[model samples]
Target: MTGWARSPLKSAAAWALPYWTRGEPGRETPSDLFRVLYLGWAVALTLKVLGSSWDVSWHFKWLRDDLAPPHLINTVGTVIVVALTIVHGYTGYGVDRTALRLIQVGTGVFLVAVPLDLINHRVNGLDITSWSPSHMLLYIGTALMIGGVIRGWFVGAPEGRTRTVMLGALFLFCLENTWFPSQHQEYGVFGIHAWDRGEPYAEPILLQFAADQMGRSVDRNMVVAFSLPAPDYLYPVYATAVCMLVLVLARLMIGRAWSATLIAAGYVAYRVLIWPLLMVADFPISAVPFFLLGAAVCVDLAFYIKVPVLRAVVGAALVTAGSYLSLNLQHTLLDSPPLANTSAIAAGGLLLAVWLGGEWFVQRYRLRGQPTGARVSATATP
Candidate 1:
């Protein structure tokens, strides 16, 4: 198992070292296989989006009207895209790390699975249930991508307190939209409400209304649709304030450790709160918390966790749980809708309080002035 795992790392080093050391900066962008894979996946998603939009019955009627040979084009296109993504991720890029490679591969697999599941849903009329394979795949893919970006690509180290703080902040920012009600009511981005009210191609017509209106008389349909009362915007404002406060607390407590924690906390909070709201509300916005969070967490964990095995386990578990919670929280919360998951919520609050309190304690003790290994390392590393 170890040998098999290490193979990708050794191969990546052999492939990347020469290019990284010798490649000219402006001559051409360095060809990281993962980047190529990312592009390929993006292209696939674009195609899927196009196909889905064109074939409205697949979405609205939930019937595979374009079920003839032409469907093969979509299927084949999807399969090829998924295959490329998996291959790209499996082959570690620009770094020789077995664990990271595995994560990449897993992420690729999940990415591939999302489209496949959607395709299946279209073809077979699968009951769109929460926690379905497709849904799980989407969540997993999101978490992996966010973790990777934050920990692997940006922060360079995940375990450090700085990385954690930064990650938390980022999460909060991305998920901030969740606390707010869907903007679809205000902007006819998706389409006019009539279009949503069984009106065919309401979105295109709404767009036309915007173009025609050009700040002229507002379309009555658009106005009425968007005019529905929603929760006070102040709630999100307050949430944002609280989120920022948390980041500030982390910064004061962790110092250089602030960045990573902020990013992580922000990412987690967004995924936990915002993304699901948008998706559940069926707003026009794309839910991308997973992508951001996955990239962030992967990079963060890489730097933070010293023990490889423990890092892998904890990172994987958190990614999975976070993704699940983020993706399905609306359904879970709305369906059963716990008024009091008090213990869990309380635990989280306690942890935050302790973390903040410790920061205060350390400051009071003048730990900043005291010569400690972290301080010495911080000073010496730069």
Candidate 2:
């Protein structure tokens, strides 16, 4: 019984020893190292959700409405994200090279199909639409690529079919939300308008209704008799909620401390450096609030991951100063008073208090049964 129990342990050690010392193909190799990169992908996905303000839809709307070419800054940002996905996906494919080939081909197909479909639609005299099958395919392909890479790292194997199917389903759901009218429809709430100009078809009816209540102009945005419900209330809310839930699940899976810290830092860098550069070129004034929110979330998450004491202190100081400067710059650029300056200051203060409180709690908790910091330090050392 003892011999049997020890056998597997000995075998594992034997397998690991050669790989570590001789650099042979064993349980650990270059492939293994690449697999570990999935943690970065997880972090990127998390920050992508938290940082993005669903304003990309507006960007797309502007592109279509204005008949302008794609913004170079946005194109560059998209290219970077796409490159990361491809690298992450390739590493994932390394796990099960042969099996994943077919899956990769399918993924590539979907990615290409989306843009082609959009082009075809435009060529057929339909309006160049932002929300379409192609866009769904692109998003789904990216998600699948990220998800498969992460799962592959853990399982040490490919999850081709499952990843593909799951992504396809997600794509369909997103499509439904994109195409469907929102549920919040109130008919006759805003009075109807006449088809011809200078006609008061239902003006009296609306005015009478308004006078009986409070005397406000009836909502003019409503169409002839029926108007599409606001998609804002449901689509974005549902999409964000589900994305956050998925992020929480992914966080549970990748629980290493150092990896989390690196991921947080990478995300912080991306949001602070990349997102604003792209968005600000077009909508300079309104971009401030969005950028600040992204910066705050990134900094907070980075702090939570707990870097070395000196590094953490330096990072915190830089983030605080940068945030303050950014807020003031925003106010100056936009020609308005600082809106969220107080809240930002309060949040920074709160973060400092939490860090100090946590340190005290840890020291006190350890000192209850041991010789203060010395014994705790000794125990913590490798």
Candidate 3:
């Protein structure tokens, strides 16, 4: 390897990028090849995660003229996925299991979704929110993209770093997907007016509702006209539910050092990476720390509990509580307005979701590794 490639920062950068795989070409193992390809795909997914909110905010700030900056980035991400599919998705290549088959299907749906989204915008013009009937196609495509990766994860005999890293990438991407909607609650400049006084729980899209991007005149009437359905409470609930679920799954699969902590780390790293961009754009930073660190610490401690059920109980509580407190504290430090609903009603429900998800992870994921006859009922540890 060259000196640049050897540096820790450079090495991390290279691994994250979609770089050429050198050496004797075909001489590389399938595991090595898959790792390179999946990491590259991960890069594209990261762009999508980043762009999810960026796209929304861009439209709020400046109407789409002609696939300018945000749209262009969106194209780059889609193109990366398309190129990945073309390069690795050869006919009769190894991915044929029922579960893994979705990889090809997802790529197809995502392809279709792109043109449909463009046409949707063309026909209806840009709607207020991204959840229009056609825009939902994008979610469908992206969901399948994730589904394919999750299924492909176990299609064949176990691989090494390829599967391991992909699992981490999956956790990271899922975290981003779960957390993206929180942007609807607060983000950059547009977030300042994200909530309404009288109907706070509804969580209306107030950006561009009254004032134009120029920040001069106000039209309070437009708030009613431009308003869309945004249930704020569900934002954290859903994000936490999904996040807790995937992180648990990641822990089950990887069995590596600091599994949960690293999951939190990935969440933090992505937020930190984007903070500068928001700062440069003159938007208030609203990315709340998702409390992966505290959850991680709690999960680690949970391993020491002797009873399986008790361990899970203790672990889930610690993680959820730690994460909630961490986020509130972070928000306080930033002086940003707190999330709309942070009560135990929401937190407890999220806690239940994480516990249930952890239980499911231990069951479904564990089944694969053990012998068929040795199936589990309640015989697993946290």
lDDT of 2 by residue, 1-382 (tens): 6999899999867754443332211122254444334334444444434333233423322322223233333334345445544543443322333223333553565558646855865654322223445655655554455444433333342335433333223322222222222111211111122223443333344334433333344444423212222332332232222322232222223332333223334433543464466446542112223223333343435445444343244434444555455546655764222234435444454444443444454345331111111211112211
**What lDDT does candidate 1 reach at residue 206?**
41
RMSD in angstroms, all models? 15.7, 18.1, 8.8
RMSD of 1: 15.7
Worst 10 residues of 1 by lDDT: 373-382
Q: Where does the lowest 10-residue lDDT sum fall in candidate 3?
A: 373-382
Q: Which scores higher on TM-score, 2 or 3?
A: 3
Clash tally, candidates in order: 65, 1, 0
Task: Please write out the lDDT profile of model 1 over residues 84-113, one tens digit for every residue.
Answer: 434433433322232244346545766587
- Kindly provide the TM-score of model 1 when superposed on the true structure, using C-alpha atoms: 0.32
Q: Rank the candidates by lDDT, best first.
A: 3, 1, 2
Candidate 3 lDDT, 20-105, residue by residue in tens: 33322122235555555656767888777766656655554454545667667767888887776655444222233332345567
* Candidate with the larger TM-score of 1 and 2: 2
Cα deviation in Å at residue 351, candidate 2? 30
lDDT of 1: 0.38
Which sequence of candidate numbers ranks them by TM-score, best first? 3, 2, 1
Task: Give each model's whole-structure lDDT.
Answer: 0.38, 0.36, 0.56
Candidate 3: clashing pairs of residues: none
Best by lDDT: 3
Error of 2 at 33 (Å): 8.0
- Best-performing candidate as measured by TM-score: 3
